[model samples]
Target: MGSYQDIEGQLRGKRKFFKQYSKIEVDDLPDDWIDQYYENGFFTRQTGSMITKKNAGEVSILTLAFLLLSHYPNEILNITIATSDFGIIALKNKVLREANSPPLQLNVTYKPPISYLSTDVSIFNAVKTGLIQPHDISSMRPNPKSSIFVEHFADGSSGLHETVIDTPSFVQICENPQKYTIVF
Candidate 1:
């Protein structure tokens, strides 16, 4: 969490594992996911396409769920994902069960505003885009960092991810509102 480089190195290992284990080529897979193989490049003959294909459906669904959560929080909270994929099903159960999880350091609407000027305002409305992670102290905080594919939002109110906005970034953003921004 402290070093972004270390985080990327870990992901590189994970990507290598995926590349080594996934045998199915991009052309043989769904059109929606073809770009992934293009991005990952060719793998060895030892790669397991059959095994990869078997799990592909669930992975796709889970990815969809995350993207959906990113845009429409309410839709995810009110929907169902009936698939064999334990991952997707787990996420469905989680969202259906928990209504208060915050993704990407973003929390649900606070129960009450600290002041009249601040209450009931969209973080987007109040701050510029990409500002959440910059201006706010919580953005750099130790979030239970999920992969790029994982949903940033909470499945429930309690266990989503940590929010640990680091000191330097926090100080910089706080001192200059025009300097910060939100990604989503």
Candidate 2:
């Protein structure tokens, strides 16, 4: 996905698909992937920050859920996106609408926002410490030079892994959806 100007530059001919919708067709995209224009109307820059309030570029929660279901068609998946953004929270209504629509059946539940989430705190700290650079903030997968140590299980298996925010890692995760999950 990209800005309208970017999509226009990539198009072979001057033609728009789903003109009324926030989507377009790009010859460069994978056959199964939908090419959507980055809708600036749905996002805003955060105060005193280079990052946008939406954070995850053009990736919508519905798209993430769809990718998950497509990757694990045989399994029952329970996907949840916790956020303090009211715009994202409002998407629950859209989720309900799509859930009731034909061809896609989804069972969705909405919960009240938690007062605080530790993960959010960690992200802020990471950004403040320069572990997550400004350029990394909007990337599909921010490959930072820094790494973090993580213990997998009681098997004593542990190692340092590249520090990446999963939610914005849509490109990498889409290539292997089963190997990753969207954390936002």
Candidate 3:
């Protein structure tokens, strides 16, 4: 998560995305991690302020569940969601009873919930469904100054992480692959 300005500026350039999206609709999540949002739909605030990519991670799990349900309904029998979001675990336990139940038809093999999940589309969907809070409303934003690399590991191969050279788009892959994911 970049600064709120950075996030808005980038999203503004791509206004087309908002046409199909809303920034305010939030998941009626519980502020108390122990109480959980899925069961109550609302909860009193306990933590100082929920921040980071927690909301994003929660949203992804919901989206993944919905997508898998609709896209591959008949073939799915079970799904093992892999995430580190408390919200995901909450929903999985409350709505899906994740541990004991399977997908309606297609069997998903996702890792179990972790504490710090990477922001992705699956989490985005959970936000859309009101399972997580809006990203901007949260108090924390990831520091872009600290270079983070997102590498895709697939097919028994390790992809490389590269340095960020420019920032009109917050980050642009370095021209030279040898630099790794460095800031300078």
Candidate 4:
């Protein structure tokens, strides 16, 4: 087993990645995460959607996951995004346009969190399979840099299209706290 110091180091690294990319403060995360970029210092696109500077970075799955882990120390989060919301689609397009990259045609399971914003089946499986143990932060520490989507697909198929959190999924995870307890 690795020492506690090693595990802590990994968590710190993940946090750093999140900070470097998202630039969102853990304490300032709005309850409505989809509206996060609407604040000042963010710019609006022709699509009427908001995103940070082309270089400032948007919040990634890992960044949001780490924020949840930091704030709610005693929860196991199961993240489920609709994968077709406008906010998300815009973000993907913006990232690609800014990066001058071609359409990254990969299964949902293969896209990097930095480039895309959708949560794949792998993330859900991690919680269900106990890889992200409920209520224990330590178990998640060792693989802090690991995308919240750590578990793999069973059938090896391409995953969901990248998108934003839809109304239903967002409400289910954030609003219905009691029923969807510990889920993000």
Best by lDDT: 2
Overall local distance difference test of candidate 4: 0.38
The superposed Cα distance between candidate 1 and the true structure at residue 145, in angstroms, equals 32
Error of 4 at 178 (Å): 36
Question: For model 2, how does the per-residue alpha-carbon lDDT over 45-70 read when each residue is reduced to its tens digit?
Answer: 44675656353532465556654554
Q: In model 4, which regions exceed 4 Å deviation?
A: 1-37, 46-65, 85-184
Give the alpha carbon lDDT tens digit for every residue of 6-79 in model 3.
75665564454333323323353235532333322222233557533334445556656656665666666665
Candidate 2, residue 1: lDDT:
45
Q: Model-by-model lDDT, in order?
A: 0.38, 0.42, 0.40, 0.38
Q: What value of lDDT does candidate 3 attain over all alpha carbons?
A: 0.40
Report the number of the highest-TM-score candidate.
2
Give the alpha carbon lDDT tens digit for every residue of 1-184 in model 4: 3478975775576556445535555466668654433332232233347433332244364345434444554463344444322255456455444332222222222232333333323344455556654344333332312122211244654233223433334323333223332211
Full candidate order by TM-score, most accurate first: 2, 1, 3, 4
Model 3, residue 124: distance off in Å is 19
State how far residue 158 of model 1 sits from its true place (Å). 23
TM-score of 3: 0.24
Kindly list the per-residue Cα lDDT of model 1 for residues 17-101, writing each as its tens digit: 4555346553565665546543442222225553233344554554455455556666444334433222443443443343244
lDDT of the structure predicted as candidate 1: 0.38
Clashes of 3: 21
Root mean square deviation (Cα) for candidate 2 = 15.7
